[model samples]
Target chain A: MDLLEVKDLKTYFYTYEGTVKALEGVSFSVGNRKTMGLVGETGCGKSVTALSITRLIPDPPGKIIAGSVLFKKKDLLKVSDEEIRAIRGKDISMIFQEPKSALNPVYTIGDQIAENVLLHDEDLKNLSKKEKKREAWAKSIEALRVVGIAEPERIARSYPHELSGGMCQRSMIALAMVCNPSLLIADEPTTALDVTIQAQILELMKDLIKKFDSSVLLITHNLGVVAETCDDVAVMYAGKIIEKGNVREVFKEPLHPYTKGLMEAIPSVEKRKEALKSIPGSVPNLINPPSGCRFHPRCPYVKEICKEKEPELFDGRVACWLYGGAR
Target chain B: MKLRDYIARRLLLLIPTIIGVTLVTFLLTNLMPGNPVRLLLGERAASPETIAALEAQYGLDRPLYIRYFVYLRNLFMGDLGMAIHTPFPVSTEIMARLPATIELGVTALVLATIVGIAVGIISAVRSNRLSDHVSRVFALTGVSMPVFWLGLMLLLLFYYRLGWLPGMGRLSVSIGLEHITGLHTIDAILTGNLTAFVDAVKHLILPAFCLSWLEMAMIMRITRSSMLEVIRQDYIRTARSKGLRERVVIYRHALRNAMIPTITIVGLSVGALLGGAVLTETVFAWPGIGSFMVESISFKDIPVVLGITVVLAFANIFSNLIVDILYGVLDPRVRYG
Candidate 1:
């Protein structure tokens, strides 16, 4: 069985203009110790999908209308808030895009990591305050060590502002890994770092994932990052995933026109092209998205039927007219 | 950026600020039309010989620069000169009344800060809810109402109609509790006099509430907006994702960051409360520096007015410095260089 399975997740944001269908019937699964990359352009509901799994969408403005996020055979979406909270940092943890802003500025790195450690640690419930603190401190240092940080003790004591971008990202990874969660959601984790630091962070995450044997839902727009680290890829356009397959399979033969465009858009050193290929139009405004295929407006090989009827995900590959609705 | 060096630099900067304040106060008070000598002695008693003698005694006959230097020298020598309207040292009068003002000001500050922060947090947490709407309306009313008017209304309602509180003064005439701290409540506590303490508190309630109402509203509005801004920050989301309790996420993660600006407002409001105390004290008949200043201002008592202005300026500056230090404490990113 998969470690986590999300089926038909739908999330919307009710704004003054209209209801924005941020994630419309999004579905995916992560197997044990496997990494699945959700690649999409900006505002394609990748982040919203991650937030939905944790039930972290801010209400009144945003709400998850329908979804079933199953973790360890338990439907997380159906659980009470308290139950989901208990499962959050323990069973599933998430690291964010901007590491610098992700950590509380006022707290020392150690204190923040220790906060997570203490919160999920049941054994510390009965311990004295000082004892719990000491245990948390020790665990935080250990977690920091796992993320390849040097002098974990000192780094933990330093505030987030005192650390470099790469160091802060390392600390974020340490925070997420401290609980040895079964599943980890990384939302554009290295997007804010420099190229060198980005590579280092991705390398560190890869190492940590191997050591912890945790399934990962890696959300990013960088296909290179997906190819380097992810075992499987799910391509999202507008607010829906248009394609999914093994990383090599998707890269070698991308079926969806959106997926093909994304692959061609990457600036290749070998080709030395004068201009990198880019999709013709921008993503649709989610408030009033395209009626059928979200990528229909941008799709190069658009057919009449494509504009009127939405495609369904077929056997192991895509949701497009080219697939001929074959199972 | 070291904390010690930063504090020393801030302290050094205060020297020039204090001097500037004193110089401005001296010049402005001296430049005013009314003469302290003429005001001291009434129109009926004023004679050229008496006026000249009084001018010479007070050094008002000296050049403007010379008089300013003399004022500074006397100020440095711990002498605030004498009150023209009253036969008492200006410093002595201020000292006698300073505690009353401090007690009222501090009580109002503490009450407003605690209650304002609580209400503000609730409003921000449940933004647009009924509680938020209620607090916003309350804040609107508080900001619009004048301090003196509020004090009078409270006095009329509680003291006259309800008969639940005292009408005026720090203590009732019958409560002869010896002055320990010059703060009735503290003195009462020190002497183990519960009745005196109760009477002192009763007299304090209406005035302190009136003084703090505007400040409370300002604090609540600032805190609510600050919290609303901070609660949307990425760290707040990170905190929530950590599986922290909603209260922990709101208070520990969101509120701490929100407090930086609110602390600044609190410090500024203390200075505002001192200014408001002039009206609040008059309406409640509370004997404090504000009331003393009000009386001195009417009589055109330059020495007393200047003395009070200098003290208030120092209070404002020092409180601001304290708030800066608190900023460093609350947010490690704020380092003084």
Candidate 2:
């Protein structure tokens, strides 16, 4: 069984303006030790899907309105708060987009990491306060060392504001990976970093995934990152997943017109052009999205049926009338 | 080392701040109507020779600058001069009443901080809900209600009507504890007089609550807004995602970040309270520096007023210094500078 199987997840944001249908029946499965890249443009619900998996969506505004997030055959949506809390940072941990902001400004890197270690590590449950702290501190330093942070002791003692962006991101990765979670969710983990640091963080993440043998649900808009780091890819448009398959197969074949447009839009040294090809129009507002196929507005091969009815996953890979009739 | 240097700089700055306060207070008190000598002498004040002789004896006959310089010199020597109406020195009179005021102020501050932070967190967590609305209304009433009216209302309810607690003074006439600290509650505890201690506490409740009500409301409003801002931050989400219990996330992760503004308000309230909760003290008939200071002002007793002003200035500066130190402790970024 897959490590995480998100079945027909529907998330919505109840804003003052209107109800935003952020995620509409989004579904995907991340296999054991596999990295699944959820790729899309901004506001396409990539991050929302990641948050929904762990039930981390801010409740007042955003809610996982429907569907089951089955982790290891257990429905995460159905679990009690305490049960889910135990699972989080132990069974499934998440890394966020902005590393510096994501870290508590008042605490030292060591203190923050040690906090998680103490919270989730069951062996230290019965230990005395002093012993637990010592163990947690030791584990925190080790976690930082694993993330290639030099002078882990000194770095651990330093607060988030004292560190550089790359350092903060490294600390964030250390915090997430410290408990050896089975599923690691990285939501644009390298987006706020320098280009070189971005590459470094991705490499470190790839290495850590292999070392921990953990599955990753990597959410990003950068297709290059997916091509380099992910084995499986799920391309999302607006609030729906348009295509899903092995990275190599999807990149080579590019069945969905939107996917083809996204690939063409990528800047390449070999095929230089006066201008890059972009998909027509922007991502639709999910509140009042177009009927049937969400990509039909921008798709080159739009059919009469595409405007009338939504297409189901054909062969459980692509969702378009080109693949098959609307199910 | 850095912290030590920062504290030293702050202490050095206190000199100028205190001098400024003294200068303003000195000018204001000296300019007020009514001669202290006449007030002190009473009916005998009608005799000019006695008034002049008494004024000369106290060095009040000197020119303004000379008297100011003389006052400053004596202040440095810890001689706060003589109280106009009393035989004891101004310092002695102030010292006698200092503990009573501090005991009430400290109790009120503690009550405000605990209740304020707790309700603030509750309101922020359940924002816009029925409980949040209720707390908001409670805070609004606390802020808007007149302290004297509130104090009287409390006394009327708890003391006169319900007859459950004492209404005025620190303790009953019969209940006397050893004068260790001069604060009845502490002295009672020190002497192991449980009954006196209980009596002191009952006497304390109404006035302390009245004194703290405004401070509590101010702190709650600050904490609520700060917590609301902090609750939306990425770190809070990070803390939650780290599998920490919600209590730990809200209290440990969120509260610390939210406390900077709340601390500022608390520091200000402490200074205000310690400077003498005049209205609260007056309404409760509590024998604190507040009533004493008010009396000195009416009598135009310059020395006693100056002595109280110096204490007030110190209280404000000291609270501010404590607030700065707390900022460093709460945020490392502030410590380095």
Per-prediction TM-score: 0.96, 0.93
Kindly list the per-residue Cα lDDT of model 1 for residues B96-119, writing each as its tens digit.
Answer: 999999999999999899989999
What local lDDT does model 1 show for residue B198? Answer: 88
lDDT of 1 by residue, A1-327 (tens): 899999999999999999999999988899999999999989999999999999999997999999799999999889998999998888899999999999999999999999999999887899999999999999999999888888999999999999998899899999999999989999999999999999998998898889889999999999999999999999988778889989999999999998999899899898885688898989899999988787889888888888889999878589998887622
Worst 10 residues of 2 chain B by lDDT: B38-47
By DockQ thresholds, what CAPRI class is model 2? Answer: medium
User: Largest TM-score belongs to which candidate?
Assistant: 1
User: lDDT at A195 for candidate 1?
Assistant: 98
Once fitted onto the true fold, the runs of candidate 1 whose alpha carbons sit more than 4 angstroms away are A122-127, B45-47, B160-163
lDDT of 2 by residue, B1-337 (tens): 3667777877788889877877887898888888777777776626778878988998889998898888888888988899976779999999999888998999999999989988998999999999899989999999998887898899899889999988788889997678988988888888999999899998898888899988899899999999999999999999999988889999999999999999999999987676538888888888988888888888878888889888877788889989988888787778777
Extract clashing residue pairs from model 2.
Answer: none
The C-alpha lDDT values of all candidates are 0.91, 0.91
The list of candidate 2 runs beyond 4 A from truth reads: A122-128, A269-273, A297-302, B1-9, B31-56, B60-69, B160-163
True-structure RMSD, every candidate: 1.9, 2.7
lDDT of 2 by residue, A1-327 (tens): 899999999999999989999999999999999999999999999999998988999988998989999999999999999999999988999999999999999999999999999999988999999999999999999999999998999999999999999999999999999999999999999999999999999999999999999999999999999999999999999889999999999999998888999999998888785577788898998889999898888788989999989998898899989989643
Worst 10 residues of 1 chain A by lDDT: A318-327
